[model samples]
Target: MKFDKAAGENTLFDNAEFVGRPTHRIDGPLKVTGTAPYAYERHDVVEGQLYGYPLGSAISHGLIVSMDAEAARNAPGVRAVVTTLEIDPLEKGMNNVARLFGGAEVQHYHQAIAVVVADSFEQARAAASLIEVEYEKGDPADYDLGAAFERLQGSGEMDTDTGDVEAAFSSAAALLDEMYHTPSQSHMAMEPHASIVDWSDGDQMTVWTSNQMINWNHGSLATTFGLDEDKIRVESPYIGGGFGGKLWLRADAVLAALGSRAAGAPVKLALPRPFIMNNTTHRSETVQRIRLAAGEDGKLTGIWHEAASHALPDGRGEDATAQTPFFYASDSIRAKHHIVTMSLPESADMRAPGEAAGLMALEVAMDEMAEKLGMDPVEFRKVNDTQVNPSNPEQEFSDRNFVECLDRGAEAFRWTDRNTAPGATRDGQWLVGHGVAGAYRGALVLPSGSRALLEGGKLVIETDMTDIGTGSYTILAQTAAETMGLTLDDVEMRMGNSAYPVSSGSGGQFGAASSSAGVYAACMALRERIAEQLGVEEAEFRDGRVIAGDTDRALSELEGQIDAVDSIEWGDFQSEYQMATFGAHFVEVGVHAGTGETRVRRMLAVCDSGRILNPITARSQVIGGMTMAVGAALSEDMALDSGRGMFANHDLAGYEVAVHADIPEQEVIFIDTLDPVASPLKAKGVGELGVCGVAAAVANAVYNATGVRVREYPVTLDKLIGGLPAIG
Candidate 1:
């Protein structure tokens, strides 16, 4: 089923029994009861499984001089040892910027160099520590983005340009130019990158891993291992957490496979917490410059956004200017991005990716521009809202309610009650103020496939879609149940297996929309098959019965089980419509007058991202994003040891995330609407949109509380203490 035309009055729209309802997670019981088998805990699947521990390179960049694994091979209970020096560099995965294993040359710190296999995890870890390695360090790596930006200023690529931005800025009534910095961030998922691989079969291998994309990893493993795609089977039914860190095949999976092949037994490997920061992918730090020019009426005339971020030579940089071109109405708009090769670590997607860091600078600049114009921040954003893409005026937004989000959010947050004068409203030693920022994230969809089986009066749906704690199982069940006119209790969903039909695989916030559409398509196929079996041209499924004119037959009365397989492919609808999610973030904070400490009192996010599939799950995603935003605003920062080209604070103790005490009240409001151009499900993505502008809103609130505008991220107290108002 190709979604070529705009969806109109479909079953999901007219007779939705579960699609748009607030359904609880179908897999909640398994998770809460600790019965769900995570990758590292699935010890009952295979017998005689050995443990594997990986050894990482000490230097960030260098060529391996010598490696002696003799000590490790002779260590207690050691079964097999595989070192990078013995094998040539393996092929890199499609989604991986840095090589997972092999090769003598190190691309970054903590690059996997060897694997030690033993009878137990402790034995494997002990054996891995005995391996000796020598390296000839290369020239000092380029780890400073500021210096790289200075060298590549004139060579930067201009991604987008509209009218003359310079001339418009020169004549604008209000102009604001500033720079902001966001530090590199770790995913810090609850479960580490873990995998268990079994290669006992002659040429067939099976891997149970905590990966987000099953199809991608399956293909990657086949390519990297020089085996046929059909020979590999990847299963990841439950993932503890993955903020884009487990999107690709990491070293844990690769090492486990290699260890299993060498030891002639199934091998399990789990990366340490420190290795997770440097070995796996992380959100790249960005240096962004935003220049906004507006008229006296609070209408934006020119908007220029340029950013510099570091990545591996073969990797793409953080595109911090992704949303600038289409976010607001501007006659003159320009966006430029510069990528600098660095040897620190692999920089890749995390949550909202580009917009998460970009909006931290752009939205804060919006607040500064509003201040220059003496206009309210929410009002300023409302006046510049555009129904069409600013970069391409021919394309109009499918469904955008940015102004409504702003108005509704401002009203709910009591924006009018905010202290207009900075540092004037004091509650004891704390100064209170409010802040607002607009959110934007593109709604993306991918071709996804699913299989449906109707057996013993129960509907079963199968896809490779991963849950990642985002309620993929629940929402997918809801989609199939609604399409088949069955209750949620009568539907069973099986996912995260490569044998299942390929799906969108839960990234870029497109998982729920695309995967659910695929299930819907498969259900439709089943409906057609049921109609054909009943000798009818068409049939309506209701109350678990197929109705054809005057004849009605219960699905349970069918002679045998019926099955259907189908996929949802997209056409040129995206070209005709600008599908994007929009929202507004409002925050209230109190700043300590003497110590410059800040604490958030409350936060509200008003989102306009098409139809909500499951309100319960949708709220969980939004609040999770909000909690991350608090960390990005106040605590989360992966301290880089630039001199040594490594992340100094690689462990969780050094790198802080938001805790219960750090988070205050959070509210999420979804604007009720359907996006026909987005998908057959009439839904867009809200996960990324929930995070886009939240950090900026927190920064703006802090600035309002204490007239000290923080240009750098993680707005720590040290940066604000010096500029804060003098103690009373």
Candidate 2:
């Protein structure tokens, strides 16, 4: 059935036995025991598979004058060397801005220029170092953010203006205008971008890669290689993690396929850690300036969120203000984004693209505005909450419980006992304080299809959807079990193969809701087929038994196997209602008075993202998001070398993510809500929403502890040391 209207009271969902239970990941044991086969580890996948190592350009911005691979080609065990200089320039994918294998003109530092195939990984690595290349610097690299800011231009499509923001600000009783900066960040997934390619007689190629979107990467590979879509296939059943890094086709797959063709054998390639940083995409650096106007009663009158971020010459800027227009209620609001063209590495989505960065600025500004009005941050947010779109009052939100989220989070975090005055609460040499921030991420659904087959009392579901450690296998199992009245073990799940039906393919935090909805559609068809065989109009299956009004039989007693395939398409509800996920974050922090060190003592998140499909997996997602946001608040930043135009700290040791010791006890509470407009499942995504306003919450806590307002990200000790009260 097409989901064109509100799913008014789904009796199946209400009667579900496992849909909302805490089901563990189905692939957990395989991953925990180190039996899960990653792309590079599949050495036995093809006969005589070769190893390929990519060589990146040494210079950042330059023209490749000449390349000499004779010595490397003649070296030991070298099967073939494919250089960009000799190969035709490949077409850039639709989602990509920079060409993965640009021959002469290099767009950024560490761009792949060649790949060497050899008998072993060591031989390929050693031979790669022998290839000599000559480069001539083209022009001064545009690495300065300030310089790029001067050239910022409005993205005409993303710009939104409702009323006179200036007039509202001028008449407001309370106002604040501030500038904040967020530096470039890396995905830093546990597994690197790796691929293994095998080609057949007809030039039909199969790529076993670690990617998030299967169909999207397949289309990209076909486009890049100038092959028909049917000739290329992509498979990625299990992903260590993506965090939006593996959404598009990267060089690993392309280079592996190209090297395999050159060497006349299957090839495998895994990008080194350094190349993962400079060669692949990273989140762009942003300079945001937010202006908030509020009344004496703490109600917002106007809000202006304007941000500028650096992207490549042909790259579209990050939509840093995408969440502002709908997050809070304001009479006059203007949200604009400016794209600054620079020579930096291409920018793409990471976690919650617009909302993550936008809230880092907007939420903190909300706290500041509240302080200006002498009100509590939670109270300020509750007062400004809107059930309708702030920019377009005619559009109503399908469901919004932002105030409840804030109130619940405050109560769970024990806000009433906290000291509002800075440095009033202390333990020995540490000063303690609390902070709160609101979270918002829009809900989206895509056309997704699935196939379900029943044989010997067991059902198998197949789709191209991927599980990037977000528990796709388990949630889908629960969905199928709940729909077909079977145990989790009775459902066999198969996915991440191009042969399966196309799915949404796990990105933008929409994987769980969209993919499961597709599964539901397929299972419904199977139920109908089963009922027809029993000669009944309606049937209900419970615990391996099918029951119609008068007829009942065990599933195994059925005469033949049943199979069905179906897809869920977008409906009119999406056009009529504004769908979004809402949550609130509360944090308690302690600051060392002497050394100016800050530590998060506790964190609690209250979310209202509709129908927690699997409590364990959903909670895990929120906890992971909270941990990542802690890194963004305290230590994550990729340093830029303007002179060399490369990321200075390209390795994991230099790039600091939050360690286990850095994290505190975290609590996640899901408000029992079912948004009928989201999908047949009545569930929305909570992954990105988990990180939405987390950083601002941590930053606000720091301000309450040390009385310092740090506008930049990774609120380091240096920023707080200057304002710390003199040590006793």
Candidate 3:
């Protein structure tokens, strides 16, 4: 089934029994009962599974001169030891910028230099420590992003340019020019990257891993191991959390595979919490310079955003200018992204990638610009709203209710009651204020395939899509049930197996919509087959029966089971329509007068991401993103040790994330709308949308409370203390 044309009235829209309802996650019972088999907990699947402990490079950047592993190999219960210098560097995986393992050169600190396999994890760790390594240290690597940006500025071409931005800025009635900084952040997922690999079947390898994209991991493992794709299988039925950190093939899977191959037994490996930070990907730090020009009416006249971000030599920097061109209306707009190579650990996608960091700067700039024009921030955004892409007037959004989101959020949050003057409204030592920021995350639908089997009146959906704690199972089951006119109990979902048809996986928040469409396509094909077998031209699937004209038959009455496999191949609808998810974040905060401490009083997010598949899970995703956004805005920062080229606070103890006590009550509202161009389900992604622009809202709230603005991220008390209002 090709999704080229705008979706007409489909079963999901016409006969939605469970699609829009607040459905609990189907795997909830298993998760709470401690029966769900996470990657590291699947010990019963393979026998005599050895534990593999990776040895990280001591030097941040250097060449491994020599390694003496004889003592470790002869140590207690040591089955195998694979060193980086033992073999040539493995081919880099498709999604990897840093080499996972192999060769002598170390690209970043904590690069896996070797893996030690033993009968027990303790033994592996002990033996790994005994392996002595020497390195020829390289010259000091460039670690300063600020200096790098200055050196690399204007070295690359601009990513976007429109009307004369300088002229418009000069002629504007009001203007705002400021620089904002967002530091590197860790995914800090509860479940670290863990994997169990079994190569006992000779060339056939099986990997049970915590990865978001199973198909991509399967192929990357095949490429990394120099084997055919068919010989490898990747399964991830349960993932604790990914947050885009598990979107790629990490060292755990590769090292486990290598250990299993060498030891001739299954090897299970879980990266230590500290190692997970430098070993895997982190959100790139960004420096953004934004210039916004607006008229007296608070209408934006010009917008120029220039962002510089650091990455590895082969990596693309954070695209912090992504949403600027189409987010709001501006006559003259120029957005540029500058990449500066640094020796920091690989900085890649975290949640929301570009828009998350970009909006932190862009949306705050909007707030500052609104204040300069003496206009309400919400009204300023509303005035500059663009239903059509500002860069291309002919291309209009498939569905944009951003204004509605703002209105709804403002009403729900009681925006009118907020203290209009900073430092004027105080309760004891606390000063209160309100702030708002618009959210934008592009909608994406990728080609996804699934297979359906109907046996004994039960429908089974098989796809490589992963749940990633996003409720893929429940929503997919709902999609299958809705499409086949069966109850939720009658549908079964088998996902996160590479053996199944390739799916969109869990990244980019596209998994639910795209994978569900694949299931719908396969189920639609089964409906066709069932109707054909019944000698009916067309059939209406309802109440577990197929009815067409005078022919009626229960699905169970069929002689045998029916099966169908299909994929949703997308067309150029994106070319004709700019598709994106929009939202508005409203936040209330109180800042301490003397200590400069900021505490969120409450938060509300109104989303306009087309249809809601399952309001329950969808709200969970939104609040979860909002919680993470609080971390981004107030606490989370992967402090870099510039001298060592690694995250200084690599562990949970040192790095801060928003905890239960840190977060206030959060509310989420979804606009009632559907984008036929998005998918058959008419649902766009809400996961990333939840995070975008939230930090800016929080930052704006802080500024409103103190009358002082902090452009740097993690708006900690240290950055606010001195500038805060004098005590009393």
Candidate 4:
């Protein structure tokens, strides 16, 4: 709450101010101590809650011929047995892109078919296994994306171009064309999707669970149930991890609500570990094609990106072209998506969504082009750099220091270790290489609102925003405390309740700036009221009190009267300014010549998120995202069983993610910057910056070590061994 007197933007205060200081996450203790409860464990609200266990289909795609609950009903402690026929049919949630349990037709493997309610969790599980159901199986569309991909209609969009690409390629002195593929991925957050549903006296209901976006889900759920929005309350105090999986309403919520209403008691439901992959959502798989043509000077004249993907019949496009139009300066450029309908579980957003997958392909392509030109990849990008977005020439960037990021990273990573030729650097049995990549993510802010109370000098802020284990509590505390000119403890922050004003929940890396701005707006209102009550100029208000020429009144004295006024709200400033974050990732790697195993030796990242509300939390966000990117580049993939059309490794043991040992000594640095156009605090989102350009750095390192070209994700060992020239 304290700012260095000389620098106004050094602490947690007003303007595009107080962005460079380091602060701690406001909600750390509650998360580490196990005191904060997740979804189904809300033992505080529902007494004698009936646990509901869901049963999934054995076949990937099929029709439910019939279901018999006699055995389940006869099971011990059974309270109720429900299926599609018995429970009130649910309308699809607005947040759900694909229909939830759409009609009795099973869409993918392990689709939940029925639920059993019992006195205890053990009883529910045991009884659930007793239900008998029959399915009429049918051949499912397999995960043969490679074979199936070629047959795509090629109709949605191919993204062909401005100046004739044929002429550009024919006349160009340098050319590079290649295809890249990335396998499907899972969120795999620590806490699985869960929901606890309880009914109030008549038509009222309350649901406590883990979700990233509360306001959207609240409205979506209300619309789905055809109930009054005020009658339902949703609270998600802390989320284990959402990635992108928890962005929408998972089946657990809809089923628990149905089960609770039927059992005449509160119902608690959690998706079993194995079912998590198929029951909920996962990142969509993509195959991209990159074709680039450059002149003798290595200036790109033509660049085209065509991305193909599969999803449920009505699934949304991943739009991997986000960074393409802004990456470099080119006269002719093409970027688009070709989507196909496949028999599979729903695929939605993950960490960086498009940027995560797009950068993997684009950066690697740039590296390959750099090698062909015998140019340093860092310098290659800088030479063709763009100061403004190519697609939107009118809306220039607020600040683009991508060149400095690359330069600093190269110096820190010691670029001299890497030579122009691959397989030229070796240390014993390891092929040593150093690589660099540019990271970019745009910051977005939507209108967000919050309500606060000032009682006896202690300030309390309330909003439906969720902490989501992303430091929502701490950043919010900083906002209020700074606004009121008080210490961190002086601000009481309440979030994760739908009874409060609507909010911009934690997703798309907008949570910090957008949500805190809502808190800042409300606090500004409080300051004005305090100034009027103290009979002083609004600009003169300071330090929990106000001053006039000869008069002084404590801020607390006017609070009682101001409390009688209506709650405060904020206006939209996101419209005027372009907010975004930029960074660069540099890496050193070692490749085993014998086994082709890729190991990270060292990593460093430089970021330019507008502000740093809490340095401790911001560092954690960067590290976590960097780790995920490393997984995407090195070893995390959801292997699919083509014949069954199901995730071959449906459980955690089969699906691999980054563990502590997988990460090297990682360092993150933030370049201090502020944007008055964004909000009073000027903090851009830091949640997803860690992952933006990571895969490219790893891919570049692999090429440096062995001179092999790989466009597939995870950069598996088999890929390298086959391309090697008889390595002994």
- Give per-residue CA lDDT, model 2, range 310-391, as digits (tens): 7777776677798999999999888878877766677887999988888888899999998889998899999999999999
> Where does candidate 4 stray beyond 4 Å?
1-19, 87-89, 153-164, 539-541, 559-579, 723-728
Candidate 1 overall lDDT versus native: 0.90
Task: List TM-scores for all candidates, in order.
Answer: 0.99, 0.98, 0.99, 0.93
Q: Tens digit of lDDT per residue, candidate 3, span 434-480?
A: 88999999888888999999988998899999989999999999989
* Model 1 vs. true fold: TM: 0.99
Candidates in order have lDDT scores of 0.90, 0.88, 0.90, 0.76
Q: Output the worst ten-in-a-row residue range by lDDT, candidate 3.
A: 148-157
lDDT of 4 by residue, 184-267 (tens): 888889898999988635678888888888888888778777889889999998789999889888888877777787788989
User: What's the lDDT for residue 410 in model 4?
Assistant: 73
Candidate 2 off by > 4 Å: 150-158, 200-202, 725-728
Better of 1 and 4 by TM-score: 1
True-vs-predicted CA distance for residue 670, candidate 3, Å:
0.3
Q: List the RMSD of every prediction in angstroms.
A: 1.1, 1.4, 1.1, 3.5
Worst 10 residues of 4 by lDDT: 1-10
